[model samples]
Structure formats: C-alpha cells, structure tokens
Target: MQQSLSRGSSPLALLMRGVSRLNLYLAGFSAFVLLAATAAVFCEILSRLFFGKSLVWVVELSGYSLLYMTFLGAPYLLEKNRHVAIDIVTEHLPPRLQMPLAFLVALFGAAICLYAAWYGLAVTLDQFQYGSRETTVLAPRSYLLTWVFPLGMVLLSIQFVAQAVACLKR
Candidate 1:
C-alpha cells in the first residue's frame, strides 16, 4: 500500500485500497466459480450415467464460468507473483537494473490492459444496443458476459499500475 497513505485519510487512496481488497474477494469468487463448475460437471455426468438424463445448461454455464474465473483470478495471480513469465534476460540482470525493467514491463502491461478494456467496453455496449443473445443452450444476453471482460481488464490494469508504482519505489 505504498500508494496509499499511512492513515488512509485521502479519498482516492482509500478508494484504491478498498478496490485492492475487493480484487482479492473477486479472486475468491472466481475460485468458487471453478468449484461450482466442477460440481456441475460431476452432476451432469452422474445424471447422464445413472438417470439417463442431461442438464442442458451445464456445459454452457461451465464455459461461461471458465471465462469469469480466468479474468477474475488474473490480478490475484499477478499480485502474488504467480503469473506466468519468461524472464530469460531479467533473471540475468543485477537487482538494481531489475526493478526498472519490472517497472517498464508493468507499465506496458497496464497500457495493454487499458487498451483492451476500452475496446471490451465498446463491444459490450454494442452488444447491449443490439440486444444480442448467445445462440447456445441458455441464450443469455451477450452483454451480461461481455461486461465481465471490460470490468476484469480494468481491475487488472489498476493492479498493474500498482505493481509499477511498487517497482518504482524499490
């Protein structure tokens, strides 16, 4: 929380702190979504095998859950240093040079995510305007799922900015 005040008296700092905390909660929700998807798969298998029945929505919902899980959990993974990386050059550099490199990488990542978020929001808005729906089992509104992409991207961008700031401080 280097970006945040010690007493957290500032409104922007407080809001960002709250958002960071919320990101963790969202990651937990993402995990729950995965667990639920697993249970759903099991349920579908059991129903089909034992009762000769099928849950038509199981596969579709599971696919949607996968998308949600990935986006929602990404920030948590990055924050924890668990995100995938190919640091062939960075690992060879001295500690002094590494922080700046990390800072640059984080800024680049933040920029990309922000760009994607902008396009995602636009796509979602277009879907909403068209009242689009998936042609799959549930035929759910397209915007319902599309909204998550922009939201997740924005959260991820913020996380990247925070990481960049921390790296700069080092």
Candidate 2:
C-alpha cells in the first residue's frame, strides 16, 4: 500500500516539478531575448550614427527577435498564472463559481491556442513550400521566422492543460 501510494503520487510530483522548471526556463529565455534586443538596438544606433551607415539588418533581425521573445515568454506567464485578469467579476464570485469559471476559461484558452498552432503550422508550411525569403538583408526563409508562433502557442496550450488538470485535482 505504501509503495503504491508513493508511486501514484510520484507522477504528479514529477509533473509539477517539470512545470516549475519550464517556467524558469521560459523566464531565462525571455531575459536572454531582452538582452539581445537591447544589444541589437545599441548596435543599430552605433552603426547608423557613428559609422554613417545603416544597420538595416539589425532592425529587421531585432524585430523578429522581439516577436520571438514575446511568444516564448507567454508559456511561462501562463504557468505562473500571472496573466492580467479583470477580476471585477471573479473577485466577487464565490469559490465554487470561481472554480468552474476558471476551468471553463482554461478550456477555452487551450482550444484557441490549439487552433492557432494548427493554422500557424499550415502557414509556415506554405511559406516553406514557396521558398519565401525576407525582402531585406540575409534573405533567410520567411518560414523560419514564422515557425515561432505555432511552436510557442502549442507549448502554451500544453501548459494550460496542465494547469487545468492541477486545478481540477485540487
């Protein structure tokens, strides 16, 4: 009985640990993105003003980096349940109502993210199929840049499912 109990609890504990670690990883990645963006911006300024030339590539690259950073950070935010909520209604609701409302919200959010991932994947494939490339310097495939959206959203959707499960179990 004791062994069974421990084994049964272990999976949940492991899942929780993984989720916590994922949040830390996401936060770290976000910080790195921020630093990269800052550096890129600084370099852009230096190249444009001091060198009397344009660092047009830096602007484009940094813009994409910013977008990636925002998406990558989203899953971490979801895990922490740190997203902004109006709370006007939730704060006033009873615990019972709150629980159901939270579940429904999570379900809806997960569904939306799942759909986004599907659509993003399709769009990325299309770009890849067409050999689309950026108009600016480097001219890397546009599909590579577009991939971040689907991947990040999928991860976020998974995180929300985990959160919803935890909430229901509680």
Candidate 3:
C-alpha cells in the first residue's frame, strides 16, 4: 500500500521539482525585465517630451526586454497550465480518454519545443562564431541576446515532458 501510494513520487517528480524552481526564477527575472522595460519607455517618453531628445538605446532595449520576458515566462506559464488553449472539445471528452489525449498533446508540444531549442542553439552558435553584432547604438553581440531563445525553449521542453509524465501518472 505504501509503495503504491508512493508510486507517483518517482525520480521524475524530483526532476520536476527542480525544473519548477528554475521556472519560478525565470518567471521572476522576466517580471523584472518587464518592469525595467516599462521604466525605460517611461523615461524615454519623458525625455522626448521635455528635453526634445530620447535615448537611442531605450527603444532597442525595450524590444529586447519584451522578447526576453516572453521567452523566460513561457516555461513557467506552461508548468502552471496558464498558456492560452481552446479546450472546449477536450473538456467534454470522457475521463477515460482525457488522460491519453492530454499526454499525447504534451508529447507533441515537447517535441516542437525540443526542435525549436535545437534550431535556436544552432543559430546562436553560428552568429557567435561569425561575430555578429546588432546594428544599434548599444551594438551588443547578437548571439548574447539570441542565447535566451534556446534557454527558454529548453526549459519549456522540460516542462512539457513533466506535464506528459503527470498525465500518464493520472
């Protein structure tokens, strides 16, 4: 009975816990990025209105911050089952079929995320190897910003695997 009760407490649960923590951190960081972007935009607006000038980096940085925030928060959103989904059909399905369907969906999502992560890493590496830089006032290395894509996708893929396993265990 104890073993059966503990069946759900597998190594996957441990991995999920770690991944959950990481996602939480990423989500918090994303929130900070969002706040910073808001501040930058506000500052730029004020500067332009009052001083007839604006920081060139503000617009570029705000765009990058928005991108970073979306990517970083995505894994956490997936883990929390907060992403947008049209589940009218699934919700009406019988309980017997629901788990399997959910598992399959998660598996498909994981596969897509894994592919994206691979592609993003390849692109970032190519940029880094070729010494690519953004054509902006800040002019940061493009690869440095691009690295967030693979990192976020990897996290999202892990969360999807966790979701699939949870569905199976159901």
Per TM-score, the best of the predicted structures is 1
Per residue, candidate 3 scores C-alpha lDDT tens digits across 1-170 of 01222246678556666777888899999999999999999999999999999788998998899879989999989877798988999999999998899899989998999999999999999999999999988899999899999999999888777777777666
Prediction-by-prediction clash tally? 0, 0, 0
Candidate 2 C-alpha error for residue 49, in Å:
3.5
lDDT of 1 by residue, 39-151 (tens): 99999999999999999999999999989999888877776668799999999999889999989988999999999999999999999999999999899999998898998
Cα deviation in Å at residue 79, candidate 3? 0.9
**Whole-structure CA lDDT of model 3:** 0.86
Q: How accurate is candidate 1 locally (lDDT)?
A: 0.86
Stronger candidate by TM-score (1 vs 2):
1
Of 1 and 3, the candidate ahead on lDDT is 1
Looking at model 3, the pairs that clash are none
Winning candidate number (lDDT): 1
Q: Model 2: what TM-score?
A: 0.82
- Which residue pairs in candidate 1 have backbone atoms (N, alpha carbon, C) closer than 3 angstroms, thus clashing? none
Worst 10 residues of 3 by lDDT: 1-10
Whole-model lDDT values for every prediction = 0.86, 0.77, 0.86
